[model samples]
Target: MSFSVEEGEFFGILGPNGAGKTTTLEIIEGLRQADAGTVEVLGMSPWPRNPKLLPRIGVQLQASSFFERLTAREQIRTFASLYGIPAKKADDMLTVVGMEDKAGTPAEKLSGGQAQRLSIACALVHDPDVLFLDEPSASLDPQARRNLWDLLRSLNEAGRTVVLTTHHLDEAEALCDRVAIMDHGKILELGPPATLVRGLDSATHISLATGTLSLPAAREVAGPDASVTDDGVTVTIATRAPAPVLTALADRNLLTGIQVRGATLEDVFLHLTGREYRA
Candidate 1:
């Protein structure tokens, strides 16, 4: 619920549905008013919609809205004109988001992912010092998602601060310098992804193709400290000590279909926020 993002830091807020991620972003972006706590962004208060702060920050909401009947290029140009930016800069922004080819396409005709990219371009057209994105990649396909990630990384490297809210744990791990995990409008944990994952002290998971070894044989090989389970498709060995188990598997030639995964951001997130489904 409370944190500070250093200058040029890539900070992420992660949570499940109804966890107040969107609401928090809205408050920080000065789109909504907060109830009680004080907020100081870039040494400026965001509440009451400070006019001086508007030019320094850019915001892309979960859902994008555009001027009626405008093309993708027109939509961004309009945004640029508000900040006294040239049309050329707006065109360059379209190229930056891979929308140059679709520049002439009507806003209503753009797909969800394409529209998402356009919205990002519009936000960046003004060359704001800080950028805020909420669920920016939710509508993107895998390839598009990777492209957006690359774009964001480049922007951050250029000394722009980025504050993001997303449900994707992997995105937070890949992009965030630090992340705050929220649940029920509260921060449950805040740290670098690797540090938080290590703090969990969780077990390693070594999975093999089902029937590679019988359940009884696997139990015998893994020893008593390790827990083994098979749900027909895969046999998983959960162990704090993986070296011995891996050696055992290698000795038996059962490593052909093996998969090994250590604790990750998702593990820490689920541990803190619970595994139940959220609508």
Candidate 2:
């Protein structure tokens, strides 16, 4: 739980439900207190609501609420007022989140994705240096999620430090510069996704179409410790060398449509935590 997030870096915390991911983030954001362990956010203690620090960080909780009857622009204006931000600043944020056209739409009328984006826009209206996003896209559709990702990338590219928690492995792989895998209130792994995946002893995977071959023959082709799925065609070889298997299949002219690919973050997570990234 003790780590530092550098400026302009997209850092991710990943874990399953009730794994303390949200608790850890809340503690860091000063929304909740930790019984033990010291936390310094942006070099300032989060407790006691440090006035200097509060204005420097923006937070988007998993779920945020506003006056249900207020329009998006009105909600933005209300939040901006809390930070003493100008009205024009709120308008700019609305434009930034693609809610400009829907500025007049009431909070209760917005689609789930639009509301989430508006919440993010409100958080960013004050022009904070750091952003905390907790499951920002958890309930969003695929297209909406992609849109949020692009917006986040733009924000990071403009030098905003973002700390994100998500269950989506692919999202983390695509957006995070580095990630810490947490479970049971402790870090199980921490590194760039590619480096962590490459560090696994099981580095190669061979997938074949199901019903395209025999399990016994495929297992014979693959050595012991190789895992063959019940479907009988997808075999994973946990070895540094995959060329030999490829060569063997080629020699026997049995390689047909076989694919060799590097391990993914999901593979590394499964190996380390014994849990699947279902989301």
Give one digit per residue, the lDDT tens place, for model 1 in 1-279: 688899999999999999999999999988889998888888999888899999999999998989889999899999999999999999999999999999999999999999999999988999999999999998999999999999999999999999999888899999999999999999999989999999998999999888889999999888899899999999999999999999998899888869999999999999999999999
* Stretches of model 1 off by over 4 angstroms after superposition: none
- Superposed by TM-score, candidate 1 places the C-alpha of residue 169 at a distance from the truth, in angstroms, of 0.9
Predicted structure with the largest TM-score when compared to the true one: 1
Highest lDDT model number = 1
lDDT (Cα, tens digit) per residue for candidate 2, span 1-279: 677888889999988777788999899999898898799988899986788899999999998897969999999999999999999989999988788999999999998888988989988999889999999996688987998899999999999999999979999999999999988788999999999987887657777776555677777777675665644545544445677767767887867787778778888777867755534
lDDT of 2 at 85: 95
CA lDDT scores, all candidates in order: 0.93, 0.85
The parts of candidate 2 lying over 4 Å away from their true place are: 223-225, 230-240, 249-259, 276-279
lDDT of 1: 0.93
How much is 231 displaced in model 2, in angstroms? 1.6
Question: Which residue pairs collide, candidate 2?
Answer: none
Span of ten consecutive residues with least summed lDDT in model 2: 230-239
